[model samples]
Target: MSAAHRPGLRVNAALIIPESELSWRFSRSSGPGGQGVNTADSRVELVWDVANSAILPTLQRERLFERLGGRLVDGVLTIAASEHRAQLRNRDAARERLATLVADALRPPAPPRRATKVSRGAKERRLTAKKQRTDVKRLRRPPTD
Candidate 1:
């Protein structure tokens, strides 16, 4: 498939990818569906170079790297889709999936959570409960002389 078709359906307008940036390969699909599966090269694999992307900022690239981790090899982000029986459909699906992934990566995440200490009242309640449990267990034991 060509980049123009994929570009028109991109989720993020800010992400303008060059035609050469995307690489796609088609393979025969696997799974149920008998004859159709054997004849169709419906499996689509779309790979994008995240480290060298012209559209993404440095921060966005870092975030994507952190989120995708081991799944991203070198600098490339790979997406595969084969749910459809047609190569074109699978190709579109793969591109759509990549768009969503990139859009998600662009969004800023909530700041890291600050560590919090237990409130004094809560600590007191816990201690009180522990003392009550100790008293109950002591009562259960036979009375010591």
Candidate 2:
């Protein structure tokens, strides 16, 4: 958290990442723009250093670090969006993706699974099946004493 508690690039009311923490790269989009594609950079790549970001609270930082570690490269998460023909749209897409990714990563972990025991009827059925298989095998063998 910054000393002045300023917020930027609002993902939601609860999660506001500062603009200074985000960086962007723009390039020519590869599809569907026709004449505009030659001159405009419609592809947007938004990069955020998630591991070292001060915007995240301690618990959220830990959750993001643990859950999204595999998706991050050198602790930086990059989201690229080029589906839209306009640069602004692509930029918004990237931002939305980043927000979604971060929000999902920061979600709380599921509760631990409780141990379960087999019911009496289930155990009896399993034993019955094993006995039937054993009896069939025994019956198939030679009857010589």
Candidate 3:
């Protein structure tokens, strides 16, 4: 994703993050990619401080914490991208991931399910099946007489 194509995310009614809230750091990536990966800083680390962000609302903050609490540390939201060979592409990918995370956090959770009781007909059917199995077992046994 290009800088021009970056989405405008509104955390609050007045505050909006238009590619500004994101901070990217490029570092030499480990693992495969031959010599290119060893020489170039292809790993992109994207950091967004959710706790100090003025854009997000209280509800959004709470939701973000609940959804991304594992990735978050010291009030900062961190995401890394190193799949691509190019640093810019990796950086863009990381930013996209962060945007996706935030979008998911903004959504409301489903309502809690209510406790349900089994129907009487269903219970009767279960008992009937058990009795039929018991009768079959009794028939298989020898008479006491």
Point to the candidate with the largest TM-score. 3
Candidate 1 structure quality by residue, lDDT tens digits, 1-145 = 5756544435476666666788888889898769989987889999888888777777878888998877799988889998988888887788779878878777778899999999999999999999999999988999788
Model 2's number of clashes is: 0
Pairwise TM-score winner, candidates 2 and 3: 3
Candidate models: Cα lDDT each: 0.82, 0.84, 0.81
Query: For model 3, how does the per-residue alpha-carbon lDDT over 18-130 read when each residue is reduced to its tens digit?
Result: 66777778899988899998799999998888988877779888988888889889889888999989888897688668767777777789899999999999999999999
RMSD of each: 3.6, 6.0, 3.5
Q: How does model 2 fare in lDDT?
A: 0.84
TM-score head-to-head 1 vs 2, winner: 1
Using alpha carbons, what is the TM-score of model 2?
A: 0.70
Largest lDDT belongs to which candidate? 2
TM-score to true structure, per model: 0.71, 0.70, 0.77
